[model samples]
Target: MQRKEALDILHSKLKKKNLVKHSLACEIGMKRIAEYLGEDADLWGLAGLLHDIDYEEIEDAEEHGKKGASFLKGKLDDKVVKAIERHTGYIEPKSTMDIALYALDPLTGLIIAAMLMHPSKTLAEIDTKFVLKKFKQKGFARGANREQILACEKISIPLDDFVNIVLKAMQEINEELTG
Candidate 1:
């Protein structure tokens, strides 16, 4: 399916505005990472955009990616479905997209939390240095998994460069993200 159709499904299921924004951020993150790694940006971005599609609908957290994967089996590429399933830690990450999603997902949350804490309260105000500092504070953005984000190393992307790429990609979507 195309992005418009994927977005339609996302909007229909996710009532919370923040979740939609999060998905959008993930889309940007996936695309940016793919570009950096010379992967298929469209396919990876689709996986990121739909990774949490079942979050609001699934009662059990364990079923999050599985449900979304099942729903998307016929619609999306098998690789995309697998990436979505792997994203929630429902399964071990096996592909490049899977590993990237597992890491990038929580980093997006961390970035947003950092933006909210910034004096300017804008994506533009947050830089890699500032984010790295916030990242070191365990109490800040506790939901963001430092360990998972560090998984970028498995794909040969250092934490600093990974964060920089994702952050820049997010900056491009500032309005939709902060809205």
Candidate 2:
């Protein structure tokens, strides 16, 4: 499906503004990471955009990805659905795109949490160092799985570089995220 159609479906499924912003943030991260890895940005962005499409409707956190994939079965590419399925860690990521969505899924939340803690409460004020420090702190954004964020290194992206890439991507869409 087209980006517009995917977004329409996302809006239809998710009523929480925060969840939508988080998906948008993930979309930005996925797109930038795809460009960095010389992959298809649009496809990666779509996977990230709809990764958590069923978050509100699914009561089980472990089932979110699977159910979302089922919800998007024919409307999106099979690869996109598979990537979304793998994002929940229910299955191992087999493709570079899948690895990216897996790695980015939680890092976006950690970065956003770090940005909120910043004195400026803006992406511009946060950096890789701050985010890394937060990453090491188990208490900070406990919901953002550090193990998942560390998965970026498996794809050959160092933690610092991964943090920087995601940070820049999210920064570009700061207005939309924070608004």
Strongest candidate by TM-score: 1
Note the residue pairs that clash in candidate 1: none
Candidate 1, position 147, lDDT = 92
Give candidate 1 misplaced runs (Cα > 4 Å).
none
Taking the tens digit of each residue's C-alpha lDDT, what string does model 2 give over 1-179?
Answer: 78899899889988999999999999989999989989889988999999998898888777879999998888888999999998978888888778889989999989988988999998878889999999999898999999988889889999899999999999898899998
Residue-level lDDT of model 1, residues 1-179, one tens digit each, is 89999999998878899899999999999999999999999989999899998898888888889988999999999999999998977689888999999999999999999988999999988999999999999999999999999999999999999999999999998888886
> Ten-residue segment with the worst summed lDDT in candidate 2?
56-65
Instruction: Give every collision pair in model 2.
Output: none
How high is the lDDT of residue 126 in model 1?
Answer: 93
